[model samples]
Target: MEHNHDNIKLTSAEVSYLWNTYLGDSLSICVFKYFLEHVEDKEIKTITTHALDLSQQHIETIQSIFLNEGIQIPQGFTEQDVNLKSKRLFTDVFYLKYIKNMTKGGLATYGRLLQNIYRHDIRSFFSKCLTSTIELDTEVVRLLLEKGIAACPPTIPYPQKIEFVHKQSFFLEGLGRRDALTGAEVANLHSNIETNQLGTSLAIAFSQVAQSNKVRKFILRGNDIASKHIKVFSSYLEMNSLPVPMSFDQEVTESTESPFSDKLMLFHFGLMIYAGIGNYGVAISESRKSDLVVDYTRLTAEILKLSEDFANIIVANEWLEQPPLSANRKDLTKG
Candidate 1:
């Protein structure tokens, strides 16, 4: 490969965006393709098809940019990473939920990418991706609503008067308890609970279908962790006399056949763990209750440890894909 770009070279941020987008979209294609094969609902199938199309288009666009920049195209996930012939591992409802979850993630990822990218072309491309993801998310939400499968956040009574916090007791911790929950706090709690519920269901499904014994055990452990986290979040809402989101554990099937490779399953789980940490960090920052903040801080640490263990497993199995990195100055000097 040669440096062919005349003057417009890719900055580190641009490189990162294209590289990660390519890798993620490649994996999405594999997952969506597998889902399309097993989905029975026509509406769900249509959504899956659209998702697949968008992922494939992203791959093509990313490949062109890499080629033009004289950068090596990443060997992302392929058809070989998925088993389209495998038996259905999840129910039709699960497919819809999964799409909704992934689309939400996609929107966040693209928004962050837009902030980092300075190139007009790259920004335009990501803007388009973000727009498409928004549309897809809307469609998934509509379908989930129509089918009566969406677990909406609990409604709260509208505040009648503009009130200000006048006491330090609002940030009470330990023995002291806060009787009221702010709308922002409630929203974060509900969102975290919903995310954990989905994570628990996914872990269960992966545990059942993972081929390697170690991988299966790891996934089972993750299922327990997610379940425990859900309980913690739900308890917060329950104490406030608020309803909690329902779990999707029943949406998984008893299929022992693997729909995806152990590598993909582990990688996907690792991504969820990272996302969980980020979500918890946000919750901790926005929460006024010291008890809630402490809980999120402890939970984030626990998940960080789990993520490290996951990385070790991937490295041991030679399944971890190296991300973009700067050159080692020490190594360069020795060479």
Candidate 2:
């Protein structure tokens, strides 16, 4: 049935995007606010300020949209969720790396959101978000380069001529010897290693400061998972004699005081788990080696199980905010 354009309502996809975006930005605001409080480097502080401003603006924009649609606004993270005065949990260099990783994730998210949105306004909003994230990513890269901390991907010698694979052995698992890694494979390995490094570092910090014993144990388990994944990815690089990316575990401080509420910390950890699954999915698609694919597939399954457990924790704690849902005709009939 054709419906009037003026009467069009928000679709489930659009509502889901908005709900997730709101939660992400709310968490970002709290994180950046805490970073701004203790950041010592002038350059890092400036970027941190810009990031916090963007998150706050996003929250306001999303709130206005929710109000207009008569949808109840999600009680996302708030001041009570963050203790800005708590001791610094990470170094300035960590902040730089965090923002850079966040920008990369934002680009991926907004790109997917743009593809899902049908309403003109929703599409336009996501387009703007994508553009802003691109700019932010550029700035972070420039700063990282200037500071000499950016790990540029390994450079390969220029090819003299075009070449093609001659046999199925090219894709076969090597028992004694293997073919050299392709640029795409190398890139995926490096990117996944870096992502897992960041996740491990964050988990370390969260584990130290988490108040609830259950939450602390869960966070520590996450740290162990991230560490194991890093090793798995790094082994591939090592077999090829490629340098592995260094872990950011040393960047975490010794402070045991909680910087964020247990609820926010749990949500933040959950978000990282979701992002990890997406990263692994992309890596598996880009990878061609049979062993590599098997490894990622297994690791992804393990993380999925952990994520399910994390969801149960959130629900038990009554911290899982419900997303917009379609009306139930069966319930309506009973009423």
Candidate 3:
């Protein structure tokens, strides 16, 4: 006989993943709904609708799990956070690419979460998440290729034979590294450049529409940071004569009307900052060349500073939500 899921309490991993998933999907729902309002291409709209449905369904499932466990349902983003009537701030191409980029993040998160999760129910849910995100990612890639907007990575010559590194210089660089970038390094650099492009576009769009001066300034600073990071990463690819991805800045419209609340905008930036940090962390660990590691480390510090500023702004606005925590033994014993 199968043990009842309710009879077993959720472990820290389970609770944290569920809570984090709720937050991410809630944010996605707002962003996707806003995208759906402005998306005009038929095929793009269909995929956007599918993405939105997945987020909504995920939110409902999480809510049900939390309520059944007697845990408080997080007041994730809602209608109040979005304005469907607001003017379009991005082009149809931007909408499609945005969904594509976001699904990549979703796949990574769900896949990693599955590694630590052991509960049957939670595992099944995240397993479903992994599968659905894979579907979304595959669909978006096909459309991107079909519509000729993929900005696909450069092709390298076929390997003639297996090889091994024999020199210690492969890992050492006193002034500047002279070794050609490995395929892994090239992949990480290319992916980072693409991510920063998306970041730059988002910063520009958010800066234009944010109501508060502080929020606008923060996002504009983020734009500069993302742009600088893109250039730094792209130079490595260019030095190797590899093609760089195209910019999405032109896809953002000139509209200054805010389609999302300041709270939601700040919260979204926080998510982006953390996600960027995680990406850089992965790049750093996977990297073998000394300079690439140093550069990634330096830029990661910059992003860390940006995350600090985000914390200050979000806290000042009182928009940050507290996640579930261990019981306060000290509080229980007090007075």
Candidate 4:
């Protein structure tokens, strides 16, 4: 392998980000292996097993990079961070949705890393990882759709026929300035990683026994979403030459049984989706290029739909949160 020996040096920030990603990937595969043990669906198990293998390979590659650079790699979290014995606590549905969101985050994060790496070998390595991550995300989505766990993006109803008004307008001319000024929005992107970690871990714990094919696919899709977001946010810090915040400060509690009530779980997910939307919105607004906005916009929409569907499930189960307003409007009207 060709290595860059020029003036190029790995900063602590860069190393930290890479280290976090390494840990994340390692944990992901380990969790998948646990999922593999209880999944009854052969096809889903096969795909997960393959994904786990790829994640293992990725960890080795990253370790090698750190070793070659004489940089001491930090020992990140592993399956030990998860309580494997707590596997009977939740429904498979909850677990799968969690995984899909996480994977989505990983994909975005890795893709951003590929964009900023300068060294030839470094760039090549990240490129390979980025491509693999995207492939896995696509596969996860496909599996979700096949199993009917994937939520379709909402579409506006269209009229059968419409009149055309061919007029030129500068609608977007000043709107970009007005809407793009979320520059002061202090979004803790690292918070996203932490939330995703907790969510995915919980999902993996339940997925061990929840062998529903639909649930497995949902978990995988969630994993992709989480992965992509991690990479995306990491890029912003890298661009500023700032540190990648890896606050695994929070303790992980394993619950195979769903500790959260169904309504609470749905609400929690709704909060995460909105959080993701805000983060991506900031990224899109702050970005100077079109492609960046386009990417964030696409992911934001996906997450939004996932959240809505999860909410739907909650409602069907009669586990929905009580509305802030009265179930009846009579009380408000009378007051």
Candidate that scores best on lDDT? 3
Cα displacement (Å) at residue 167, model 2: 0.7
**lDDT (Cα, tens digit) per residue for candidate 2, span 56-152:** 8888888988898888889999999999889989999999999998998999899877887998767777788888888888989999999999976
By TM-score, rank the candidates, best first: 3, 1, 2, 4
Best by TM-score: 3
Report the poorest 10 consecutive residues by lDDT, candidate 1. Answer: 1-10
> What lDDT does the true structure give each of the candidates?
0.88, 0.88, 0.90, 0.56
Cα lDDT of candidate 1 equals 0.88
lDDT of 1 by residue, 1-335 (tens): 34434688888889987988888888899999999888888989999999999999999999998888888999989888999999998998888988898987888788877988877778778999999999999999998899887878778899899999776888975446786788889999998888888888989889888889888888888888888888888888999899998888899989989999999898889889998998898889899998888889988988988898898899999987787888889998994
User: Per-prediction TM-score, please?
Assistant: 0.96, 0.95, 0.97, 0.50
Per-residue lDDT for 1-335 in model 4, tens only?
66655568765445655776675675566556656655556656666776788778878888888888886665543554444444434334433544556666666677656666666766677777777767776777787788875543322235589766342221232334222212222144444554555555544543433334444455556656776666775575455454454422122334435422333333344555655776667656655444445656787887887777766665676544232232467765795
Clashing pairs in 1: none
Kindly report which residue stretches of model 2 are placed more than 4 angstroms away from their true locations once superposed. 1-6, 174-177
Q: Which digits, one per residue and each the tens of the lDDT, describe model 3 over residues 1-335?
A: 57588679999889988998898899899999999887889999999999999999999999999999998888889999999999999999999888888997998898888999988888889999999999999999999999999977776677899998777678886644565887888888988898899989988899889999999999999889999999999998998999999999999999999999999888888888898999999999888889989999999999999999999998888888898788999999999
Local error of candidate 4 at residue 295 (angstroms) = 21
Q: Backbone collision count in every prediction? A: 0, 0, 0, 47
